[model samples]
Target: MGYIILSIPVFFLLIGAELLWSAWTHRKVYTFPDLIANIGCGIGSQVVGAFTKAAIFGVYLWTYDHLRVFTLPANVLIWVITFLLVDLGYYWFHRLSHEVNFLWAAHIVHHQSEEYNLSVALRQSWWQGLFSFWFYLPIAVLGVHPVVILTVGALNTLYQFWIHTRAIGRMGWLEHVFNTPSHHRVHHGSDPKYLDRNHAGSLIIWDKLFGTFQPEEEEPVYGITTPLRSWDPVWANFHYWADLVALARRCTALGDKVRVFLKPPGWRPADLGGRERPKEHDRTNYLKYSTDAGANARRYVLVQFFLLLAVTSLFLFKQDSLPIWGAWVLAGIIVLWVMGLGLVLEGRRGALTLEAVRVLLFTGAGIAVWMSVLGWSWWCAVIIFLGAASMIHLTALSGEGEVAGQ
Candidate 1:
């Protein structure tokens, strides 16, 4: 995670480059709300993961300790093989997330974006790590040290980040061996033909060998079959599970109720129309989810979003040294801050009031944590300034819609 924190600037640099590419090439590859939602989901995932990874990764370490068949030597050959094994593990996990119902609920947030760009790569479900770690336990039992698995796993993940872009075209021969942008774009597609097609991590061979590979033909219509219209990243993580729970309650048979989670996403009992299939998307008539925020509201959320990012990066960097209770409280505040700002962008009723409450609460919490760490200082004034400015903007936006520039 420390390495990921260090890599944060590079991620933003590439995203910024992509934005410039859009400007130069005249391609509308990003929208304001979608980009915010994407990164917000990512922030929540990291926050949640910081707390959850110990227990989840513990299982792998335990497996290696007790269940190992061979105490493998830490050699270059072993490192290379472990890297491939990690990729294979991720391939299976990624495929299962698409095929299975409960796993889909964990991974669906990644596909919620209608637009594909570098930021979309940041968009991930908070629950995905909890579900995915189970898939790698076999490698642990096979005697790959947990350290090897963890390091290579991070590299495999970082490799996929660059592939989540629109600026890059199809790589010629590399397309056959590796997961390129074209392959991943198809994975993000909701079109009937492209649904659940390419599920590769770094190597494309897994998909080719497993018979799930599909070449990019037409430009895909991105996102899931059922669109997640809301910008609230918190809701994006749980919405599918809520849908599954509602579906379970509707079933008459007890077994069918349990099957609601065990079955694939569109599956249903015979009484409830069997299963839903992906519609043949007519590209000409399709509409992406568009909930517009006024220009000023957009500007407000944009400013606050960056502030949240900076604080989130700091928290991730220092979480190990922070008190457990402080870490938990700060994590909750970040998640709520994301929700409040998302609601504001969605222009929902009472969103400004909620944002106001969030500003006051987080500001107070920030002061408490700061005073404890460094004793009272002028930094408290900076926090108060942000809170005051946020409140003032909320007041201005209370009545006005899109005012003149900031």
Candidate 2:
């Protein structure tokens, strides 16, 4: 977690560089709303992970203490071996997430974005850490320290972040060895041929060996086959599960109902619809999911998002010292912040009302923090000023129809 927090600056720098490169080349790969959704998912994942880590790590530690076959020393050679093993574990875990139904419920969030870029790399599923840790328990059993596995896993994750871009072309031989952007783009591709292919984490060797590899020939059409069609980050994470449960409810047989989760994605009982695979769509005709928002709304959302990002950053940095209840309170506020931004971006009917409420909540929080921490502070003044200005803008926009900025 510390490693990831430290890399935040680098992530922003590379994302900025990618934006510049895209503009300079006239090959735009990002949309404003999609980018916001991506970052929102990323922030949500980190906050959720912070709350879940202790329990997840506890399981790993228990497995290591009781189920170990042999303990390995923390040597350089062991580190190299553990890294490979962790990557291998990620390979299987990632593959299963796509092939299995329940797992896809968490992973689908990562593939919800229609555009692939550095921001897409940050788009992670908030619940994945809860289930994914089970896949790496074998390493703990093998006597590798849980901390070592965790650190190596973080490095594996950081390595994959750069591969989530179109700016970099295929590296000749490196593409054959490592998971480069070309390979990752294919993985994210919604085209039938690319579906469920290239499930490597940091190494392309797993894909090559396991026969999930596909070369990028035609340009890939990015996103899931059934588009999420909304910007709500929380809904993006849970919608698939809701769909699965609904399907199960429609089934009459107990076994079929159970299979709704056990079977691969797109599978259904014959009574429900049978297995209907997603057909490939023509790349030239592909359209991204979008919603119209006025200039004012867009500006408002961006400012609110950045402010929430700052609050989230502080929460992450001070999580150890903060009380558990306080941490959850902060997390709830951030979640509402993201949801309000999403609603505003989508130009939902009550978006202005939601944003107005969010502004009041933030203003109250600022006052509480100021009164509790210092008698008076410049930070409180800034928060209150921003909140007041946002409320005014939201009020003005309330007269606009469901679609703002349009």
Candidate 3:
């Protein structure tokens, strides 16, 4: 519940920081659309994680139900030690999530955003929880209660959130001891030197002890080496999967195909090949193209930022009471918004229509929230329906933005 409560505010904080940085630097870059995408990623990942873990734990408890093997610990010191052990367990799991290729597939979604901010922290993987619990089973075997493990895990995750930003520079001596923003920034960096470095959670000692530590030099470059080409959540999550599959198909030798898939993004098969690959760049060049979506999409995202904020406000209000239907409505609106944003970013002519449709849909969300506050009936749903229909019509009639200084 604390995680859910803080998620929205954390998002806004990140947005505020991004805006301030842009203003200070005299650049107009906006990361609000990226924030919306991250919100989807975070909630989606947790929901998928919860269901997967529930099933796995159900089987574990059911199998152990008859063993008479468990007793909840009563001592306070032992519980504290157990919690610390859990953090240590997470240290290893988090480390492996970056080191192992198979695990990295799920972990990569969080690093997809080119801009590093609190929103990047929220960008999570839908598939991470499916396999991540295996790393924690040792705790269960050691007789630590699952409740204690969960509490520690939540704390470990919460502690890492503050480290995702450019607002705070290195923390002098604390840089050597704690997982500061500088250390985590290096972790997110695609700089050849920074790749696979600083893989710690809640403690920086692991990286120092493990020989993977690297201090932030000249402001770390964020995002994966190969930037994601689309804004769609499904594409964002599975783009690497698709890339792997295509690489596998291109390789005639099974071993080569498997190897290519596991190797870093730029690998290629020797005998069977495709077009010439693009040249790789020094990590320093990353920021140049970090938020460079096409023109139409930028406009669409600008509107989306405003519109989604309205929808998000409503979602927050009804979050506790309207879990089932409200979730779907919010999800549907978000999906369409991403689609529209992508189309505009790609310079599609139909984006004008999408823009119109989105405005109506957003207006409907606003009206629905207002009605709910005023104690209205199901007629409120009609606003969303009409808004959705208007969105479709708007998509059909929209055009390109007028040139500046006309």
* Model 3: per-residue Cα lDDT over 1-406, one tens digit each: 4454456676577668777887898864446456656766765665445336568776445433443255557378757776567666666777777665566777889888777777778788888767666666666666666666666666778788878877777688888778899999989887677887888887788778878889888665567877775555657778777777877887888797678646644566667553334344564544443334445445546655565555555554555565455455665666566556555544455655655666665566546645655556665676567567556544433432421111
**TM-score of every model?**
0.97, 0.96, 0.75
lDDT of 3 at 314: 51
- Candidate 2 versus the native: TM-score? 0.96
| Span of 10 residues, lowest total lDDT, candidate 2 | 397-406
Q: Clashing residue pairs, candidate 3? A: 296-344, 297-344, 297-345, 353-394, 353-395, 354-395, 357-391
- Of candidate 3, the 10-residue stretch with the lowest lDDT total is 397-406
- lDDT by residue (93-188, candidate 1, tens digit) is 999899889999999999999999999999989999888888878888989898888888888888989999878888999999999999999999
Worst 10 residues of 1 by lDDT: 397-406
lDDT of 3 at 161: 83
Clashes of 1: 0
State each model's C-alpha RMSD to the native: 2.2, 1.8, 5.3
The list of candidate 1 runs beyond 4 A from truth reads 401-406
Please report the TM-score between candidate 3 and the true structure: 0.75
lDDT value, residue 1 of candidate 1: 60
